[model samples]
Target: MGRRFEEIDWRETPIGAISLRRRLDPALDVDVYEVKLDDEYLMSSLFTVAEVELARLALAELPGADLDVAVGGLGLGHTAAAVLDDRRVRTLTVIEALDEVISWHRRGLLPLASRLTGDPRSRLVRGDFFAAVNDPTGLDPQAPGRRFDAVLVDIDHTPRHVLHPSHAAFYTAAGLHRLASRLRPGGVFALWSDDPPDDRFTGTLAEVFGTVRAHVVTFANHLTGGESANTVYVATHARPAGLA
Candidate 1:
């Protein structure tokens, strides 16, 4: 058996100190990978149903093949890997704020590192996701004002509870409009939230997109022996009345 607990990587980022750790879980008899920022747990390999669902549900909203996608966070690479699982996905650009987290994938520190980095379809870009959404050039720095078929985000805990005060604006209707501007017509935007469904946030999404859904994804919690839930908000950009 590998070391029971090993910190794979640790770095002090502008936001806070982040670390990756692996621990053998006796209950499941598997090594569990975890990520923590400061004292707060960010993500875990043990519970990734919702992160994978974030990519699945968003892509389901998209219509055509050869889809170009963008992922906001690169926590454990579960979400990004899920995006690439769809054979229809032609390209994936993951925007990560911390270079440290990106390095974890590039260095093969995380379990899904090779799956993500080795994929020719994936590009791990170091930049602020939220900032890029609002930029006139949009999410892809290489292609200015480039629009995507779908944009999946798992960065913040919730619309109301953000990692930083600056991120709170991205949850607002106006901020969503900025994000919509970065998508092709009929494009979809999906977000993962730790909080339960919020009616107010749903209303905000309705203001920007034609269709909005709040999916409550429940998964078995190994530690608690109970089911825990996460929310995924899927919003589709409405094309002009005459356009396809």
Candidate 2:
């Protein structure tokens, strides 16, 4: 028999309805939510295989080095938690735009978020990631003069399809050039998408970075007993002096 949804209490924001559901075969509990305008699946606490893989790939590119990692989104804190698992990571700064989402994690409503919050290496910034990345004044001492070793961005469903219109620029050619500037020499930029990236985005990455690779991850559905696939885009910068 198929599983049914049950109510889950949310103390942070009243803009959406939250619920929990159970799957028969896998026999797991999943947290799901429906936002006011977004009818699609916003997020869940189920399987996070792809999210973990994204972190793993980014860390692998920076092997044997202590890394200052910057994460663009903090959904359910799965990716953040995965990134923090690496002892080589010196510091992890997550930029999330939603204050209510931050509250959910800080208040212990989102168990994963709460756990990540306890980690001394983790800090959250409540603002648009694009603006934060482009800030020149270096208002935040932790960010100024610090080029990231790895930037893991999961703010969009797909590279071509962004949830927020304001994020469109970040995936463009010019925008990618700006993003590449934020990376330290030999740094990596990792992006997760629900589908394979469009050619334009891939072309832009090729233009800005020396090495670019794409990988697809497939997993069995925890809820409906089906299969799903997602793609991750990884680009590594070349030594800057070579560019000149």
Candidate 3:
């Protein structure tokens, strides 16, 4: 039998707003927040296959190494939560542009976030991730480094389908170039897209990163309850020649 939707609560945030919805599935005993922009459903917490998979890919690419991870978005904290599961992570910095979303997590609206917030190794910054990345002042007092081991960006629905007009630049060639400069040697940059991106975005990644690969992860049929294919991008920078 399929699960049934239960109750939903609406909440406003400084960035925009979100709707917290509940499901009656005994297996999944929690509420999911749906990020909304002018009544449109932008992202949700119910199904986070792509979000979790992105973290897994980043960790896999940097095995046996203590990692300092920078996460761009904190929607329901699924991706951040997944990243925290890795024991190899030395520190995690989550930069969220929406103050209200941060407030929601602070007030216990998101269980995963609330749990992770208490961890000593995690730091949450309420600001624009782009500016934080580009700023050398260092957003976190504890993390005083120019580069991160992995940078996971989930700031938009996709590269082409940007929910916010300002986010458009982050996917462009120039925007990506700035992002690439923030990564440490051997660092990986991963992004989550609602679907596959256009050739321009992929081409730009190739131009900047040198080594790029895209992985498509399909959710379980029972979970989807329908047919859909989800994709995420994992691009890494190649060490310059003669650098070990």
- TM-score for each prediction? 0.98, 0.84, 0.85
Candidate 1: lDDT over CA atoms?
Answer: 0.94
Question: Which run of 10 residues does model 1 get worst, by summed lDDT?
Answer: 1-10
lDDT of each residue in 129-159, candidate 3, tens digit only: 8766556654344556458888998877788
Candidate 3 residue pairs in backbone clash: none
lDDT of each: 0.94, 0.75, 0.76
After superposing candidate 3, which stretches have Cα over 4 Å from the reference?
1-15, 23-32, 136-145, 221-224
Model 1 lDDT per residue over 1-244, tens place: 5899999888888889999999999999999999999999998999999999999999999887999999999999999999999999999999999999999889998889999999999999999999998888889999999999999999988898899999999999899999999889999999999999999999999999999999999999989989999999999999889986
Instruction: Give the deviation of candidate 3 from the true structure as CA RMSD.
Output: 3.4
- On lDDT, the leading prediction is 1
Give the C-alpha miss distance for residue 143 in model 3, angstroms: 5.1
In model 1, what is the error at residue 77, expressed in angstroms? Answer: 0.5
In candidate 2, position 193 carries an lDDT of 87
Residue-wise C-alpha lDDT for candidate 2, range 10-116, written one tens digit per residue: 33333344333323333643434332223456665555788888899888888665788989888778899999989899888888877766766787755576668
